[model samples]
Target: MIFVVTPKIPHFLHFTYGSRPSFSSIHSKNSATSLASTLKSISSSPSLISHGQQLHCFILKSGLNFDVFIQNSLINMYSKTGMFSCARSIFESSPTLDCASFNIIISGYLKNGRLGDAYKLFEKMPLRDCISYTTMIIGFAQNECYEDALALFREMRLLGVVPNEVTMQSVLPAYARADGTRINAMLLHGLVAKLGLDMNVVAWNVMLNGYVKGGLVDLARDLFDEIPGKSTYSWSTMIGGYLQVGRLVEALALYCEMRRTDSRPNEVMLIHIVSTCAQATRLLEGRQCHALALKMGMNFHDFMQATLIHLYAACQQVELAYLLFQEGTKDDIPCWNALIAGLMRNGIVNEAARLFSIMPQRNVLSWSSMISGYAQNGKHRLAIEVFHEMVGKGFKPDETTMVSVFSAISGLCALKEGRWAHQFIRCNSIPINDKLSTAIIGMYAKCGSIDSALEVFDQIRDKARIVNPWNAIIYGLAMHGKAEASLRIFADLQSRKIKPDSITLYGILSACCHAGLVEEGKSHFRSMTAEYGLEPNHKHYRCMVDLLGRAGRLNEAEELVQNMPMEADAVTWSTLLAACKMYENIDVGERAARNLARVEPSYGPGRIALSNLYADAGRWNDAFLVRRAMHNENLARSLDCGVSRLCNALDLT
Candidate 1:
């Protein structure tokens, strides 16, 4: 509320804030403490830096800038606002500098990401205190020099400077992010307890986050239950951690518990819950969450709206999802992306594309949404086209977008384009993780470059981290008719003690099918339940039926299908019937054709195979009868009509 009394002083005081600086108050300003407090308050906000500079003019007018406290405050204000030269000028002008003077400048440098400069200044300090050590430690930690941060903390402890809650808070993240074997959550918990910081919710929250990031959700949950007077961050962090690690049921339960508590809830917790319900396709719970958000007046938040849309789309309630999107602000790009992603998730790609075309404004995420949607729906040409269009428009593709683009490239089997995409990922310096590795390896394999795929697989420094690349290589080898080589890779996967998932089993079974390795396929199928403890899903059962039927083990294949836990799908019967036609087995062929008819009555291939089997078995009347039935059902179509199916052609010849 300082007012300008003189015309020489800027009129912003009067014109902007409707006040003027009073010279009488300036003349009577005697208390340096009061002036320092005023300076601190004015300079604390980054938005008020202009006002802070104007106040400095008044301080100099009154000759109070000579005060060491006033000098230090000015340095802090300048440094906080990124005016390092101005801050350093004030520090150099101070005739007498205290430890606080160095602390302010050093903290400013650290905050500005000038870690080396902060360290240089720290080394020159004539004397240091706990706050000085804490500032440097926090600086190193924030700058991701985690080891240095922890080392400094140890030195601080050795110097007998007892740690405070802030110190514990600063150092806990370093421990959490450190090598897991070197850390014990209990050791830090005991240290925090010994410091009587158990009630320090921030410290506890940090510890909870540490445990979650370390992949020890059980420990995090134990600490979460022990936390007294939890904050919104506490609930949000725990719920988010639970969701991140795939503990959906528990996360939902915890949200219900949070709602039962007397404490106020934040928008983040509900958003996460709604998003989780979407992922799980729990439409009932998602609707309940929507009702809760409305009750708490949280539904209007942008994230909540987007997540509600995602929830509806995931559950196949696309109409409701689009209705929700239309009911809200269409100007919001994230909600639009969410709706588009939802459509893609529900297999409504054309609707997603239509909405994307008309968006008033689009961010990088919008383009990425279309790219990812097109890739997911097997519209590979559209995916690549949109990607080039986005690039032409000057939007750089992020990792997720590149992954989708690579998938599209793989679908086209464009080796040159795939190589360019791989080079682009490297040139852009995108860190190659498991999913990216899977995508890149798959791209190379599908593009008719198995050698490049193998090179990529071998270059993975830590291949044992996940079975993703291994699965890709195995499946790719199988697809390339290198079934024995694929089996060898599977053997290596098992030798490394890497647990093969259902997809891994699928790849192994596919290798066996491709090579007609009946005994090996049967062994692996048994090991699925006995060794790996993974129950065979429909894909596994289907692959096995194909393997046995291809091997001419018609009786064994039929038995396997008969004993299947679930009803046989059309593809399973088609596989068996095709094998029967190849082997001229009338009994199994007739049974498979009947089952295929029951499952997919409009399918023509099953009838064609049956007629072919009858003709091979010299049953002309039966073959003629099958052809008549197909014609009656309108299954007899023109040869010119092109086939329609997924573009993911797993041609494991």
Candidate 2:
């Protein structure tokens, strides 16, 4: 005989056995309670399948095979063992199923990253509970399906499912990941308040983190202040929030406050504080943090060492960074890369190269840093060589690496390499973000391919609606002597409400100079300070001097150079001298030449310009004297190149 009892609970079934005869007497001797206990014990064992199979066989033989209790245990064991198919097979083989069975299979699908299957099983469920909804919501959040997570949260609320703390925790982070979800975050905060969970520290921290990530630091700070008993995570989140918005002073102040409190600083807090110091350029504060780390015995830790290296490097103390790098373990890649990048930033290329050669391991960052460093420091050939070497080493280049390579190609005016990079980007389906698009435009422009540059500019115009590509296009057009087109682009930029920075004004002024638009250049120069609030830097001053000098306003150019707030550089003097040579103005030309020679005695181009100015005026003796000075300075080769350029400019070959 057999007996079955249906419990008052919604989804639980209990089975019991009475005396049985013949083959069914195997487990009939043992009670159902004892058998269920045995099955649970088997589920906990290390080798689940072997023990579970024995239990299943005994259940079948003992005539208690259809017990829901035993079947549920089997599903759990299979799921735990990562045998989802077996769990599903058991669920399907069962004649009766409940919410518990569906929940097990759905969770198994989620665990195995089979979200589609999980959702499918969930949709087919005859009954759903809080656990079912919460599981799916958490799964969506974990997978970065934030919209789906929030949508489900709303639906859960609509269906009168009162969410517990876990549901709120799962859904809050989804809002934090996106900027447009701030309103949703605030609404959730209100819901938490209505649910009387606002006082909960975990809830408070989640809300604070969401606000911080949404770029609402003030709101985050307000909420943070309301938390009576803040946790370490709360303090760190606030500090990181301030740091994210570049409120370095507030971040430091908060750190100081955190130190005064009973809560001790942890690794996460220390890392953020060190970063704050670096951003604020507070070397003294950074040293204090370093001392604290040492006192806490975290100095030699790989992550702490990397942060310290970055801090010292940002403070322009490369030697300190190097010392830390050398003192730390050699196997840490981040430490090595930080030191290498620091050396490169300080223009210590040879040392950086030496370190790169001996790096225990190299990643994309190492190669990208080396390539970018060489390109920025004007070692374009070496940069290109390193890029090709990185490719040869089978390291796939990311966007940053490609950007550096394109910049180097631009510097060398290597059209072939530039074309190949563009093709590679397309073939690899690399997203043409604004930075890469600007780099591509610059490469084409600098390589004397204005049409190609313009074409790229038009292609990315709709998507890359930023100032960088505009600057690149305008500068390229200016370089190619399309002054009108450059100005037209500048006008369009203003019409689009895209404010021009100093680089944009410089490009405009340069276009004016190239097109001999003196009055236009003067007006734009004045507007740089008045309209755009951009004070004329040295480059702007040089452009103005060149403009005035080229228009034969020699006296005004000289006066402008003399009265300029900043000291004129060698390029400024050279530009005036070149203009004088073009116009054969010996009086002002001699003054400009004298200044140029004094400022850059070794600069062969200036000397050649002065010589050509004399030659144009038939001053053969003076021209010969300039050549003799070039010989005296051992700049004969540079003089030869300069003379060739001068001859082409003056039609005097």
Candidate 3:
């Protein structure tokens, strides 16, 4: 039998209310019914608190104040109006109460962010139900107290209280938020299926969110297909999952399928899709999302507007990006940051600065964008200047800002500044995670401190698990002509069972080139496709050509170029031609020069190298012809390709 305590409000009110206004006549049934209706309506609108107060006065006079229902309504009214002191006073004074009386005050505490109070009241509750458990669970989950929420769920299960749809919805997200709880999610799924909530779309969506967040995209897709009635949220969860894991092809395919369905997408989902498109530089899909947003009349808020500006800039449509920024709410900082970041991405550094200087308000992100943008555009000195300015203005630099600052210091090869940044990172106690560790290593390596790079690499706990630190050390060794040391590091990486990525391959190949390791280079080139399933790109092939040419393997180098699936570009031909010139191989050098000219008619380096090769070989006539062609190429093209390319984020230390 459910417990129900008898109320002592009549005795409590004797002292609590003190006195009541004299009623001219007895309260009729119509008056009591009207009062009940008014309280219910007033509960939803906090603005009618004064009107509710007037009703409270009427209650004390009508002798209906003893009613538990009337007291609950009054407590609810005060809670909704953010008058928690009054709500708690009524709750404590009432001796007689039911389950709802506890639930109401508990919900009031929860809505007001008083979890501790809510839990205390719940423990004191004379009776509890599914609502009580679910409310507490949701409250804990909202505050990121996932363990507490899940514990309460277990307690509810142990008490034999059946979970409703609301309970499942709250519990699924709680488990998802907690790390190492994916297994618990499966158990919850079994519970949900047993309870016959399998067809519930909200439950399915929450479960799908769990799978996505757990990095199990394939499992999420499998479950997503099983969902009977897919909602807009379902599609967004799956699409976002794919994007988060960098599965752009899969994300785009799913997006196409979503478009074919009848469900209209929500603004947040569309906004995220647009944002991902910007990061991947997928211009076509980004434009499509923009058009759809316009057609669907999604709210043009600062964030979405900023994302659009970033998208346009990423696509190299600078004018469109500028126009959109001009038309947006200029006062909003996000739109301004987007415009500035876009300019940086497209190598419009000066324009980004101009806009950054004039923005009405500046946040930490605004300062970060400027520092990163300047570094990206090869203005390392300017990047450092902006970083100091940001700190002078009292904006504490976050990890991301420090990453950009270290990058600029690396660019300038300023050992002093790099050391200062390192000291600052330690003083601030920033966690040296994989990305920051990699950046710090790269900075030290490029600043002519290979020993420091190795020290940083050794200090990282995830050095073997992550490829970046290994890459930095190997590249640093190769840069310093410690080719044997670089090779040994690669061997150590293999022994650790660490899978090497493209950057790792580049570092090893460069190491081989520096050490003149013909056999080692050939073995790696073959293993790239044979063992690692990695196809060697143009750069890899260029390194091989330089190695083989330097080692007098001219025929093999020529054959590799000829058999490469992709056409040999200017860099490849230049490498081959340089090798040919070293060995005085006129036949191969001529072939390389002709191909280089065909591919890049305005590349002066290829033509100049060919002329030098001829002049060194005493082929005066051929050298004169090459010089004339270079002169004509220069006259035909006013801008050098090299200069144009370097202006757009191509600087290296």
Candidate 4:
């Protein structure tokens, strides 16, 4: 029942022996030849595993079971089809196996993402040959098991296996992914020189990428210069290395040099340079490349077209990007995703949504792009809606998708939606690390759920995650009338040698002012200037003024404001004026109002505070005069509702 497809040959065949010399004999020869040809074709076509199996049956029936070529091909075909059980059976049953057979099986397993199967076959291979070892090493490296790959390479050396060009090519990439230290990379460089494997392009590329990725761009260029008989890959590697590290000018220069050398730019070179131009936001440079691509007649390739979309989007040329997208002949899903993302980048949310809705095929990237676009445009509701639709379509979101969704929920302050995302993440066993966990805490804090924020903060064992989570907890506690607790946390941060940033100091100072801890507030203000060497900014000065004002020490607060090195703006003077009104200190209130009017001539709060002081002092005519001035200036103060809540809760006694 086994059948293999091969090229049709006319009137060719083989026979058992000289049985007869008739038409049947001629036809039989042709049939046998066709069958053999078919077997050869099936062996190479990775998609014909089922047909290759049928050919295997024919080989068995025709007594060609001992044919080494036939057996090796069967093993390779089965591995390609992910029929590892069948490949194993053929491999074990075959009395003889060569390095080629082992390599084929290992490569196939690696391609199929079956690392365990690759390792098992590698273990069973005889001779511990270099090809076999290199194949498995590459498998481990590609699978991102970098540490294991390095361990295996070391074991290869312990077995007295001399490292060859193939060995260096396969194992050097593992070092790059591991972010191996400069010393470690230098050690590998020495090994390459000692082994005389400099001509190994893969090893050299890996090392170059390592240095570029590690911000050792100078070192990478030095190595590139030393490379003898540079190939197109060498030039492309340098271009990409420079591009990766944001050296757009260097990458472009290298690309020009590559062209001058008559090296034909490939898809990789085009994508790398175009991406760099996009990042640089150089619209003019990108247009030249677009013209060059058209001249080179590579405008139709999917990768090149995708880069064009990205380039136009990044340059903020939405109209031009749209025109290019409309003219695109190819309708690949990636092309559509790129265009939609471009539209989103330009703040054309409606256009992006339209394109997203009509996309013929939507993958995770496409779905995530739409969701992120909605979130970026402050349309979180639509973002959540699209995410739900994506999930309904059975598209499982990855970590990137989760991060976007987390951001959307936080932006909308939709804790209920955030809970759903959390549930999905938990059910899927996604690790709640700093990025996602911090977003969750931030969402709760924004929604006025300090208790929830604290609960999440407590669960985090690493204080070095970010200063943000600490800022959230401290500010939330201070706002919720827990100044003592907030101050304790701030002290703890100092005790642990965690240098508090401006936000940290501001939050703690505000808490002290609200709690009427004048001494504690003064202590912090002095420490901030004298101990931490942090120059008191306007915010810090304002907090200090508020501290004295709330403690009914109006004279001291007025003196602080008067002596501020920088000009006291409306906010600083307004705080002092509000404090004066609260304590009914008319003299200081008038002085603060005069200072405020000079800084903020059109400020409604300044006029209003002055009017309030006049009304309290029974100066009806003066109050009316300030009101007329406010009316003439057309300065209106829309009371900030959030700040109103804070002020209402404050006990200014």
How close is every model to the real structure, measured as TM-score?
Answer: 0.65, 0.60, 0.64, 0.54
Q: Please write out the lDDT profile of model 3 over residues 411-475, one tens digit for every residue.
A: 99999899999998898787776778888999999999988888888788344457887888888
Candidate 4: which pairs clash? Answer: 2-54, 12-30, 13-29, 13-30, 14-29
Task: Give me the displacement of residue 110 in model 3, in angstroms.
Answer: 29
What C-alpha lDDT do the candidate models reach, one value each?
A: 0.80, 0.80, 0.79, 0.74
Across 6-102, the per-residue lDDT of candidate 1 in tens digits comes to 2133222233443444545645656676556555655545665776777789889878888888888788768767688899998877888999999
lDDT by residue (506-528, candidate 4, tens digit) is 88888998899999888888887
| RMSD, one per candidate, in order | 11.0, 11.2, 12.4, 11.6
lDDT of 2: 0.80
Q: Which stretches of candidate 2 lie over 4 Å from their true place?
A: 1-254, 261-285, 313-319, 346-360, 590-653
List the candidate 4 regions with Cα displacement exceeding 4 Å.
Answer: 1-207, 227-241, 262-265, 430-435, 450-625, 639-653
- Candidate 1 lDDT: 0.80
Q: Write the per-residue lDDT of candidate 2 for residues 267-301, one digit (tens) a residue.
A: 87888788778777889889988998998999998
The window of 10 residues in a row where model 2 has the poorest summed lDDT is 1-10
Q: What value does the lDDT take at residue 503 in candidate 1?
A: 89
lDDT of 2 at 570: 79
Question: Can you tell me which runs of candidate 3 are displaced by over 4 Å?
Answer: 1-220, 228-233, 244-264, 461-466, 495-498, 607-653
Between prediction 1 and prediction 3, which has the larger TM-score? 1
